[model samples]
Target chain A: MIELYDYELSSDAYKARLLLALLGVAWTQRYVEYYPRRQHRAPEFLALSPRGELPVIVDDGTIVDDAQNVLVHLASRHDPTGRWYPQNDAGLTSQVSTWLAFAAALTPTASAARLHDGLLYHHIDVDEARRGAHEQLAVLDEHLWFNEDAGWSWLCTVDQPTIADIACFPDVILAEEGGIELRTYPAIRRWTDRVKAIPGFIAMPGIFPA
Target chain B: MHGTSRWFPVIRSEEIVPRHIAFVQLLDEEIVLWRADDGALNAWENRCPHRGIRLSIGTHAGSEIVCRYHGWRFASGSGSCTLIPAHPSQVPPKAARVRSYQIRERYGFAWIALGDVEGEPSLPELDGLPHLTLRSMTFAAAAADVAATLASEPGIVVHDPYRAVWERMGDAAPMLLLLQPESSAMTTLHAVAGNDLTGAGRLAFLRAHNAWCKEIRPRIVSEESRSAQASR
Candidate 1:
């Protein structure tokens, strides 16, 4: 059995939960109070993750930290059809890895703004974070717009969705909490709707089902 | 607004697919645009009358739009509240309905009129020509200001206060552009290339125009900001 350390409000943790449900894998959630209690930074929790991230999954004594790594690990090991990770094709694998790295850039910008506005993390420079988020979103919108012309639905130039879609979903969907309106990014908005329509899709606190 | 009675292009026809809620703003009024599965086009006030929640964030359930907050369902054409999931047995009041606007599809674009519009959207330049709609872009400036700027350019022809048209030097097809006033400080541009392009040609044409839009957006935004600073 796999044990996932989770916080309900953490989008990073929700990524693991969403993939788990999509894969139909059995797992047990170990709730860790992230806000106010600050249990993620505690010594006991530091032994599992030194950087104090909310999501750290343990599967049969193998521990995986970081949201992107956990996604790659789960998809590589569990997905029988090899559609999610696509590690067999070198070109597709490189493209997926590139988007995974791009998804990491959202944490400090979009996620930081959300933290400052919604979670009382007043120490963050929200305006700067918001500006960075818009820049990133514009790149995403342009890419997705061109992808539509090629008749590709996902992030990569593939018919099926990859881990890149899952990696970027939570931050982009919950961007409104950070005062980031998606009205200008029409392609990105449509992509989010397509993502929500995927089979076995789940919602978080701010994101609604399609 | 004084221009409320006139038609303004809000979105491309293909963009408003069935079972999806598209949000747009016209002259500072938020609107929810959706197409029914039965091919009915609807443009309504973005707010849910029950709690003022944005209907743009609601679900498009084939023939109706369901408010995300309370699960209130409003039907397609009439905007009438059809069902209240909390109290399904009771009939909803007649007044419980969304305010709808006039919308018509013309030349591959969705033209919306916020007030009492007289007739269908008539454009002489388009005259039933084949066109490829480009991706829409929003600029941080007033619509009139953007239109005025374009009118001053060398080759661009200003058809009306809200419309413009231009052509590449040797190309047979003309590019017709429409301006949508999202607010006093924001404007969105919807464009169509008057040509029947397909496959790679369509992609290339769209990309070229998108690049042009990207170049112009910053110039307009910067000009607006500079003028705002001077006025202050």
Candidate 2:
């Protein structure tokens, strides 16, 4: 049985979880509730991922820390003729790759901006991190503008869900808590809703009960 | 999540340049983009705690960030509700603040987040290669579903795609997959370089790749059960 660390607010963790569901892969979600104390840096959590990040998938006695790596492993290990991952779709692959990188820029920036804005109460003001988040959103806006009316289904196509959406969806959507208005970019807003419409899509934790 | 007036980057900061308003996207919530008068940037949750009117959409009068719906002004630095148009004589409580974020400039750009994180986000390390800004679009699937599609493909050209945008460049950059979940939004396309492929040639290769994505990425049929929150 595959086991994943439980995290209510981590989009990275969702990436792995979603893959397991798509494959009907049996797994357990272990809640790592470390509040009032940064348990991610603790020894027990550190054993899972030295970086103390979420979406660490433990499979076949191997612990995978990074989110994309876990997805790749699942696809490589599970898919026979590679249906979920087509061996030939280069654009979809590149888009997924790009979106993952984009997530790196958007997640912390948006969340941090929310903090500087004082959206959440407890943690904040570590050198004003939110500044980077808004800029990141602008880049996304530009991308949306470029293809606003293309009617492209996925980040790469119009038919199905791509790794591109999974790679970037979690953190981008969370920007709302930090006071980001997602409605500005029509394409982004539409795209986000489409992702949400997907079956089994989970919501990020709100700015309470943490 | 994508309506124009519904989610706008309210206004540039007095100290912030026009080309530099951060996109504060709230998923089904009001958004207000703000920058400081002293280059100390701050974007607030569009909803004001007192009346739920947007504070970031309004103009700045003196040091306060005001609301457009009503002339309620909150101090940008502290998010304190300072002025009430209906009751100008009243002194609002300390909690009369709009949700806000820490904004700053870095790497020829600005970033935002919701907490006092331990450190700034480090950029992704990549294999050296001239980059190409491939198309960016959102999909109707989860990051896992998307990643599975990419990994499912051992090679980089999926013909008969769903809907892809192909660049006209002729060179093909080696495919490198990076699923960075920390930063929000959907997938990112990082171009890889291998051998003596010309820039144009690499672009062509990417174009083919894009075509595959738009044409053939899997159509995920999600289930109807809500699980606990997770990541990309």
Leading candidate by DockQ: 1
Tens-digit lDDT track of model 1 for A1-210: 789999998989988888888888899999999997989999999998898897999999999999999999889888898998998789999999998988889999999999999999999999999999999998899899888867888899889998999999899888899999998887788899998998999898999898
> Stretches of candidate 1 above 4 Å error?
B152-154, B222-232
**Backbone clashes, each candidate:** 0, 125
In the order shown, the candidates' Cα RMSDs to the true structure are 2.1, 20.3
Off by over 4 Å in 2: A79-84, A114-128, A207-210, B1-232
Chain A only: list TM-scores of all candidates: 0.98, 0.80
TM-score per candidate, in order? 0.95, 0.45
Model 2 Cα lDDT, one tens digit per residue, B2-74: 2212111122222133212233342333445545556456666767687675453355554666665666777
lDDT of each: 0.88, 0.53
Q: For model 1, how does the per-residue alpha-carbon lDDT over B1-232 read when each residue is reduced to its tens digit?
A: 5688899889888878667898899998999889999999999999999999999899989999999999999999999999999999989989899999999998888889988888888666667688778988888788877887777666789888789998668778788888999998889988887789887877788889889888776556445565786799
Docking class of 2: incorrect
- What's the CA error at residue B20 for candidate 1, in Å? 0.7
